[model samples]
Target: MKRAWSPGAVYVEFSSDPRDWPSVGVALLVLVGMGAALVLSFLVFDERRFGCMSGIEIGKTLVQVALRQLAQLASKNDEQLHREREELALQWSAELKAAVPQAVAYLESRVDDLDARIAELSSDPQLRRVYTNFNFEAHREAIDERRRMLAHAAAGLINPEITVERKARVERTLRALDPADILMLHGANLVPGRMRGESLLGTPSGGDDNPGRMRADLLLGTPSGDVLASSGCVRMQVSGGGAGQGVWTEVFITQLGLDVLTALRTYTQNRKLSFVVPGREYKETDRTEEAARKILAALPGLGDLVSWSTRRSSQVERLYDRPRPTRGFAVLRFRMCQWQDWKLRLENLIPIYDKAEVNLVVSAEVQARSRDAKREVFVAQFNGPHDLLRYPADDCEALWT
Candidate 1:
């Protein structure tokens, strides 16, 4: 057999011999059966792979199905997320709506108070300066009732009496103090005191030089019952005792302290709190004053110490050295001989010495008029034989004279 290829067909040539014919006939039959088998195989395989659809059509269908399923899954997931988000928003909205009105009302009442204050200030021409000077923004968040009332009362004071600068300072000071610090002034006396020192070289107890004992008086009495020597409310004096020969400390309320206390007392009276009015009750049982008198009586002094309750007392003129006059506490004076005896007696007076030191004042320098200045001022205790005087003492001033 021979074969040639045309554009689309195959040509075959066979030998004319009968032997060749029979072989050729058998080969032809085999070729036809093989071609038929191949056709059948193609049809069966097409049915199995694509289920009667063409390859391209089947591929398109698969892509559509995948896209449709993905879209459905995304839509379901989005709906689930949306439902959860909506539920949370509804809960939060309900809670906020229920609570917001009460918060708004409370804030509105505060605004109304501010408005009333503004109206009151504007009505008085004299208070216009205070209105202008007051820093509302700085004090906007101030919530303490006592402090707020104090500030209002302080502002209501006539203007010329309190200069613009001083008023501004007082306002700032008012806000700076803790409520307890302000309240503590109720126990402190207005008897302006000082802290002073003297040379202990010539004194009898000077030889026993212990620095700790020298300044022990500073810790004797604190207003807050703490070790603080001076709060900003009180003035502080320099404690000078080169290498601890002798040191004195005293406590006195500041002008600002006095003003704040007075204002709070005056304005906050009807309210919940009030300041203690210092007089008969405060002076009568005052621990420091009582202790001083007990200590003085026990001491082996020169003569009987005179206490003049009234200016017209019969013994007033006899005292060539006048005793100091203070506003809130009693005054006692001890002479040089008296100081010596007092020192000797202090060791034996265990009751007064060992008692808790409350209202026992330290000292500081202040304006002369602000304090009681006199000769023979009350001396609490003389550390040595020399002299223990308050700050701003005269030269060689006797301890108590």
Candidate 2:
């Protein structure tokens, strides 16, 4: 179809065929050009009108971003600083913890060293004397005051009206004082006596007999008080006495008397004097051979085989001479038998056997005297295998004999 167009009027042509239409490429190009132009225009207008405002907003946004970054950096810095502070504090605490014990130990060691040095210095005789003199001079008043107090307490202790509890306390205080001081406060009487002689009063071998003797003289013109006696026999080295006939006496006094005399003597700077009681005397005798004989006599069939001999070596040799068919055990039990009816069991026997020849040389020492001369006797008993000895030996002998 052909279409005519006027200058002022538009002419239109309709066709159902696509070939009659404009090229799609050209139409698209035109439309793209129009859209591009429109966009370009709008961009130009926008650039002219709001370009500064947009720049201001961008600047504001940049400022806000910078501020946030700065704030974050500041927060990080603060956190880092806090962490560093914490670390420093922890480090300091650790250092202190580590150093404190060392310091204390060092101080203690120093103190100990100082004390040791002081002690070493004090050990010198000259230093010790100086210290003693200084101490005596410095504490003289204090010592005097203490002595006065002690004296007051001691005087109060003797007061009859004082309470028992108070007196007890005072007495304790007085005890703490020098014993010489106490003795000087209270007067004491001294009585002297001599030991005349000693006798064998009774024998323990007989019934109802006394076993020991005590010789003491009665004190005269002295207060009724405690008794004190000297220990052992005191030999007085005085003139006009022979060597064997030297004056020997035991002074018996009350216990209080002893204390008072001891205190006075010490206060007066007297020589050492014995103030204890004499111990009982004991005498013993050996009766080994006699006991062996008695024991051999008591045995049933041993009377002929074992003979009593004064020498122990012969008896021991005789025991070994017998034929030892079988291994036999032999025991010799020795004991002290009292003459009185009372018999005490023996302990600790010397073991002897046919195989043990060394034990034959061993001998027991016997006492020569006993406290009771008539009563105590050494007894011996034998125990062995039945094949060794036909009879058991039970015998006794006087230790002195």
Candidate 3:
């Protein structure tokens, strides 16, 4: 029953120098090695199967290392993708939202897509065939349904928590602006204000009736569109009208137009063609030069009655009267050259008239150089005290503004 050892079944090898050994001893050693191999073979079936188990352990270790490295790389990639998504989201919410047109377009496109879907649903004949569909116009019926839904949903907000900061910010920004800068203030404070008769027999007049006064802002607007204020209240006066009555009419002059019509002094009461409105705040258009006035006169509103002087073509030697600003009234005098028919220039010319008095412009011909240029003289004349002119006549001054 004992198993026999066979050299063919199992074997061992020796590589040491066997040539130096005794022949019998070597043969005996070889026989013993063979016997040991045969005994080992009887115990185990195959040596290759034992080596295979060790090889499996080494392969498992290599696989675990490779898997760990792959897992780490995948985690890094996931983190990078998350960061990229976050950055993109922030950019969309921040800088992209600031673009007014693009955001509006996106909202409109979404609404339009919804509209298309709603349209498609309403026209679905198959749906109508299946359901107990009543006879209804597609567009009209769809609109009615949408309206009903909108009425209900209107109470519920789509974007209920949008806060806006407009009112206070607008006020703060307006407060920051400097409209009345001193750099814009022009002219010296020449005359300030004067005291006059507090009308005794009047209807509780609470206004100043004084003569010498000027405004702080001497602003001027020119036909050239220049705005400047150069001088303060310049005073003027006028007298002689319906005297000796229980209430005699008296002429008083002050720069109430300037807003500083308090107790002020006289500028130069002597004699001057141009009178200052006292403050530099008068409109720039009011002080436009004669040349610019001519250019504007060709235009609609600009062509109405304006102040100008005239000379007679009959006698160049005769002196012509320039527009003179008096204390209570402004005056313009034009000469009649041949006492001829009224010219077109005279027709278009406006005669100043006040609400209190009605006056007529007796037109005649006069040869005079234009203030713009001392060029060839033309003839036209209008002379009449303006305050005497009344009503619709008074409205003529409006052509200048």
TM-score per candidate, chains pooled:
0.29, 0.16, 0.18
lDDT of 3 by residue, 130-153 (tens): 212111111122233322222211
- CA-lDDT, candidates in order: 0.41, 0.34, 0.31
Candidate 2 lDDT: 0.34
Clashing pairs in 1: 194-363, 195-363, 249-362, 249-363, 250-362, 250-363, 251-362, 251-363, 332-378, 376-401
Q: Which 10 consecutive residues of model 1 have the lowest summed lDDT?
A: 384-393
RMSD of each: 30.1, 45.1, 35.6
Best by TM-score: 1
The list of candidate 2 runs beyond 4 A from truth reads 1-53, 112-401
Q: How do these models rank on lDDT, best leading? A: 1, 2, 3
lDDT of 2 by residue, 1-401 (tens): 34678888866555567775665556555665555555445543555545667755644544555557668999999999888666654543443344334333322322334345444644556443432332333233234333333333322221222234433433333333443333322221211111134112222221111111111222212222111122111111222235444432223333443333322222222222223212211115423445544544543323422333212322221121111234333434334333122122112223332234222222333343467675444434444532222222212111110
CA shift of 250, model 2, Å: 84
